[model samples]
Target: MTDHKEAITILGKTIHLGESKELSFEVAKLHTFNSVEVPVFIERAKKPGPTILLTAGIHGDEVNGVEIVRQIIEKGINKPKRGTIICIPVLNVFGFINLSREFPDGRDLNRVFPGTLKGSLASRVAYKLIQEIVQEVDFVMDFHTGGSGRFNAPQIRIIKGSKTLDQLATKFGAPFVLYSKNLNKSFRNTCHKLGKPILLFEGGKSFHIDNNVTIHGVNGIKRVLHSLGMLATKFKISTPKTDCVFINESKWIRAKYSGMFKATTPIGSFVTKGDFIGNITDPYGKFNHFVKADNTGYIINVNELPIVYQGDALFHISKELL
Candidate 1:
């Protein structure tokens, strides 16, 4: 049903942006009430080739990725040489509207992939996304941020067993390439199962945009596109050669008791199994508890807030060694 002559169409209409193009994409209705219409932007070449999909707002609070995709399209880099690039800047439109992390029905869209036609709100959205975007693409790069009450080191997540994804991860130019062997029912997992390598860029926190992270992410995506032969650009410099750590095991340090907490370890700091990381203290300093590391690794992520509750995750410790 694809015609090379009609390179661009939106909602069954041929849209001519002179230089910029837009399309109205749709997601299924929630509770059988209303459908969510989304915007899709593309820059196509007259010649046909591979298709790349760029998606963000999977978690509504991850605003940096949304802005990064918008800026990339708005800037209009070197035109595609052999294929097309489709950017879905916002995927979870309903969660994005309320600045929430989950769908209105409290479902996580990322957890439900290749969803059902007769399912919950999150499942329906997943089905529509996979149907409209995933099935038609050769490559995918989904963007994300930290989850609720968490912060992440700038990293890319790639499936561990694939040589193609491993090389693609380095092409992204991120400092850390997190080898996520979990393979949960995530978008990346589903795409990998279907033979499409997807790279996930995780940076900063939710509901806020970090300029540095955004710039790095955009640059990384462009670099990958160029590597994939989709864009014509001179390779100015070789990608930084960093040994990827296979992190198969990690744990979260939680508060032993509820109190005002103070952190002593900074992110990316190395630690031993029994090192004191922080403390919980009463207002009058009458009762104090010391938080210590239970594993030998680096502090890849930690809580930024001083206030905490019992069983609250305070730090994420993982080893990037082997």
Candidate 2:
């Protein structure tokens, strides 16, 4: 639904048609009574159209996600042609400030969606987001990266079997389209429950910014907005160099021995059965294990950690394709 009316209210501020405003959502104060706010950027075109929300940095350490959204705002790509564009680059400001993946209370913001006002600090922030922000948008594109120590290939993740989501993911044109179910209590799940269409973009790793990852993310955003007829005229949308591989099922390749590890095979590369993907060896060089692929598939995520114990996940390989 398009907000074609006079003005839209957000965070207690009334923003009229075609107005650009920077609003802040204040949730807490620091120990010294310093107020913290999560900045929200809004851009609206005079013409009536759909509103799309671009968000990232749910985990404070996911700087890659924050950078992707920042570039969108800095380059003026968020200036829409016929609708509204909302950007919230850093959602977990507290965790971001502390350089952590969770709130000061040790709660992961991503796991507390549609939070309660009187719950933990993370829950309060989540509640504020869903109440003051998410409800105002028609569509959403949330950016993310692999967990610490794992570098993910550029991919668009959505639940399988929704033709609308399928079409949107195709338009996004990332290197991979992963069919992942929404996690319980996650923001994706909360938004889906509210009937909002969301496309989760994952790339790079936490606290690391890769040029390739940022490029893919920005380009994918452009393409998706272009498909929605929301991208501005000055912006150019290009076809993705390769057709995104649609993965229906996947599994992780774990370490067999506790030791130093390194991956010889690059991420996003296809490997057949028994291919030399990586190796594990003791620091004293007393043992060496050359890890091999268990089946034919593409490598979507590679654990970049230098040391791993036995059974630690190393590579995420595709198993079934659509």
Candidate 3:
């Protein structure tokens, strides 16, 4: 006999989430526009445990997270040994199509969460997702990356003061755990309000895939699943060595002059205030603008490309005070 179809009731319609197969559901129905539904499922292992929601591709340009999820599900690392794993690989298809960060309506889906039923396209998607998935999950792991020309260290961001979330994040064993205060309109904040602990992993950059980062992300997710007892695997994930510091202060060092950029400091390097981070030189190598750090801190992210415009953010620094 065929396995019983794992299913969820949405819009009064029973959507089948085949026990061990990838499934897609239409989030929006457009006649002239080609759009598909959101994909969700329960990778149950015939045991009982906590439910974990894995989301990626909320920003279309940050495609690395989507690829990370795909690799995990397709490679069998996401095979749950207990509870369920709900994986949404692409949350913004329109943004993904043109390799952009926002939806077709130019809205950042991550910034508009717990959205409205009768709102804009982004709001509608957020509404359906919240109703159909978020409300049903025990824990959430949202994936993200630096959007368009920015790069981030492979790190996990947990809401400040959430001991449970922080503990869970440290267990995931990512290289760094950043204490991020919840913004008013972010997906993490919405989930926090709903009492669901969500961990956000950020790395790579838009339009680029770092193979090592993808692997690290997948492994981290699996480790979190294991820690929650949703997987039977006994992978020993590490706890943070020091108290994860709160990244309460951060600033983007912008290019004062537009020219060809040459980065002098690399990501992960510590810099003092007023130190040169990079240089912007003209095509003929005559005029040059020196970019300097405004604060003393560890560089968490930097733009690798050798190009810049006035006001372009070249480096991101999180205050070391914690």
Checking candidate 1 for backbone clashes, the offending pairs are none
Would you list the C-alpha lDDT of every candidate in the order shown? 0.75, 0.92, 0.77
Supply candidate 3's per-residue lDDT for 18.
Answer: 29
Candidate 2, superposed: residue stretches over 4 Å from native = 1-3
**Model 1 lDDT tens row, 66-171:** 9888887777643565567778899888879999888887988889887887798788778767775677667888898876656666678876677887788777
- Output the lDDT of residue 214, model 2: 98
Name the candidate, 1 or 3, with the larger TM-score value: 3
lDDT of 3 by residue, 170-264 (tens): 67777667776788778888999988889899988889999978977977887777676665565444444444434656778888888898888
Error of 2 at 92 (Å): 0.7
Q: Which scores greater on TM-score, model 2 or model 3?
A: 2
Global Cα lDDT for candidate 2: 0.92
Order of candidates by lDDT, top first? 2, 3, 1
- Candidate 1's clash total is 0
Each candidate: RMSD to true structure? Answer: 4.0, 1.1, 4.3
Clash pairs for candidate 3: 25-37, 26-37, 27-37
Clashes of each: 0, 0, 3
